[model samples]
Target: MQIGSIQLAPGAALAPMAGFTDAACRRMAARHGAVYTVSEMVSAKALTFGDKKSAQLIANGETLAPYGVQLFGAEPETMERAAALIGGYAFDFIDINMGCPAPKITAGGAGSRLLLEPERCGAIVAAVVKESGGRPVTVKMRTGWDAQHITAAEAAKACEAAGAAAIAVHGRTREQMYTPGTVDPAAIAAVKAAVKVPVVANGDIESAQDALDLLEATGCDGVMVGRAALGDPWLFGEIRAALAGQPLPPRPTLRQKMEALRTQIYEMCEEKGEWTAMPQARSQALYYMKGLKGAAALRRACCELQHFEDVDRLIEKVYAAGNR
Candidate 1:
């Protein structure tokens, strides 16, 4: 699959999850087999104003090739400026985040709130595309702001008309934020039917089967995995296998899981320092430790962990126990 100048492998793509799909996590996902990864959503206004932190979010950090940088904003001018600025960065494409369900974003008439104004969304996409310097621009959006406003098909048409190369649709409206099993595959299907550009299905795809099911049901060209990838980057390879009609890959061995966990920890620390990275590292560790022997105790231990040295010793014990 191609997005502008970059060619993506045919498989699962990593969702641009804030606070999670950072550089370190994207690198891990790329190594494990994601076709492409998107950086966490950077604020367009911040980028326009030259916010160093937000601009830094687009910098390459061992992320695999074919990566995009996602941006969120309500204004066309700011979004266009941000897109133009990032065109010179290391990203392969530019993604507009019209799907984030967070209240802080939607309340400001950004994110999924863009669903309430399809024309304006199109204008924003058009301006960004024009300013993107011929880079492929994409859009990620939910079905609508709420059940009462199911506009994904309309939005998809708008995005395409405005020059988006591809659009990804999440199955839920903002009203169903993060609710399990609420994703409407029909909505994604409708979007695929409405647009000539490639459409990607995104929602609660947690397994290889989920990805295959989505592709079959929606006829989407791609699938974007979100929360399911927490500490489970290998899901992309498994999804690729399922799509190719191959047997599901084996689950990670105890040692392999431990090693992956350690690598994520060290990478997080390396990128964000030990002090600030620990809190989220603890959360990620719990996901890796899920369903393991003595997981309850181990989760509690991780929750209480404050120091990397302490975490290493505890992980060693957990690894030894699981091996036994």
Candidate 2:
């Protein structure tokens, strides 16, 4: 799938998760075969207001090419101004976030709430596209506001007509809120059928088989992995290999996984300083402990982490628990 000049071979991307898909996590996914990665969502209104934290979110710190910064807002003028402000950055494109289902985001009439008004969705897309510095403008959106609406097909068509270079459909309504087992691939398929632009399917894809299943179900040009890539960024490589009809790569050993996790955490510390990054690392560490024996105890340790030494101590406990 090619968006403008960006060639996303294998059609795999790292979805723009609010706090999780930061620069460090994005770099890890890129190294493992994610062809595209978007920065965490930034508030268009905040950027327009000169919010320092919002400015920091779109910082071009990662070395990966074809990177993008995602922005969210209800007002077309605010989104247009925000896109123009970040035009100096080295982003290949600007992605409009219309899929976030968080209460705070939806309450502001942005994110998935935009799905309720397809015309407004088109206006917002057109506004951003007009100021995108000649770069392609893309959109990430949900199936609809709720099951009763199911308006993804209509919204996607509006976005395409308004100059969205591509579209990513998360296969659930705002009401689902990432609930387990609620993904509706049929909704994603609807969006794919409605848009001429490249369409990417997202939601509930954890394994290579899940990725293949979504592709078959939606006929989407790409798959975007979110939470599953937190500790296991290598899932992208596995999906890529599966799509290429090649043997899957061997799963990393426990020690290798630990090293990978360390790389991710340490990079975060370097980028944002230990003080600010460690608190976030607590949840990130828990993602790595998923499905392991004594995970309950490991998660307890993860929650108390406060510094690099704490992470080191936790690693020792993990090794002991794994009998490695």
Candidate 3:
């Protein structure tokens, strides 16, 4: 699939997930086969104010080409200014985030709240595009504010008309907020039909078949994997194989899974010191334990991780559990 001039060979991309799709994670996804990857959302307002942390989030030294920097904010001028500032950075495109359903984001009238005003959504996209140094600008958004306000089609049209290169629709209203089993492919199909730009579908895709089914159901250009890919970067390889009519690769063995987790943790440690990365590694480690035997106990151990030696010890315990 192609977004503007950027050609993505695989039909899958990694979704921008805050606190999750940092450099280490994006690099892992790329190594596995995600055709495109986006950085965690960076606040446009914060970047304009010289927020170093938000600025740091846009760094993509570890991820491969076709990577995008995602920016979130409600103000058009601020987003425009942020785009200008980002012109010096290396990225394939600019992604505007309007799908985040977190209360802190919505409370500030950004994220999913932008869906409440279709015109404002168009304005923001246009503003960013104008200052994007000729780079394509994309938008990620939800179906709407709520079931009663299913406005994805209308909003998508407005964005496309205002120079958006592509649109990614998370198939749930803001009210749904990641609730399982609530993905509305019909809403995504409407957006695809309403716009000429490529549209990517996201939500509840946990397996390769799920990715294929969503593409068929919504007629979207591609699929974006989110939380499901947290501990399983290989999911991208599976999706790529499925997309290309190739046999799926064997699932990672328990030892292999443990090694991948450790590699990711050490990479995180390299980027942010072990002390800082270990605390965050706690949750990441738990994701790798999903579906393991004695998962509850393993998770308890994962939560206590505070140092590199602790991770090695946990790996030993996980192996002792004989999880397949």
User: What would you estimate as the lDDT of candidate 1?
Assistant: 0.86
- Per-residue alpha-carbon lDDT of candidate 3 for residues 8-126, written as tens digits (9 for 90 to 100): 88658999998888888888888888888899999999999999889878877744748999999999999999999988887889999999999999998899999999999999999
Candidate 2 displacement at residue 66 in angstroms? 2.0
Candidate 2 lDDT = 0.90
Single out the weakest 10-residue window by summed lDDT for candidate 3: 56-65
Per-residue lDDT over 1-324 for candidate 1, one digit per residue giving the tens place of the 0 to 100 score: 666556667799999988777777888888888888899999999998889889867877764657889999999988988888887787778899999888999887889999989998899999998888877999999999898999989988988899989998989999999888899999999999998888889988999998988999999999999888887888988998888889989987777777888888888788778887888788888888777788777888789767777668767768666643
After superposition, candidate 1 runs with Cα above 4 Å error:
320-324
Best by lDDT: 3
Per-residue lDDT tens digits of candidate 2, residues 1-324? 889777878847999988787788888889888989999999999999999888878876756747889999999999999999998887789999998888899899999999999999999999999999899999999999888999989999999999999999999999998799999999999999998999999999999999999999999999999999888988989999999999999987888888888888898899888988898888889998887788888999999998877888888999788646
Lowest lDDT 10-residue stretch of candidate 2: 57-66
Ranking of all predicted structures according to lDDT, beginning with the best and ending with the worst: 3, 2, 1
Local lDDT at 280 for model 1: 78
Instruction: Give stretches of model 3 more than 4 Å off.
Output: none
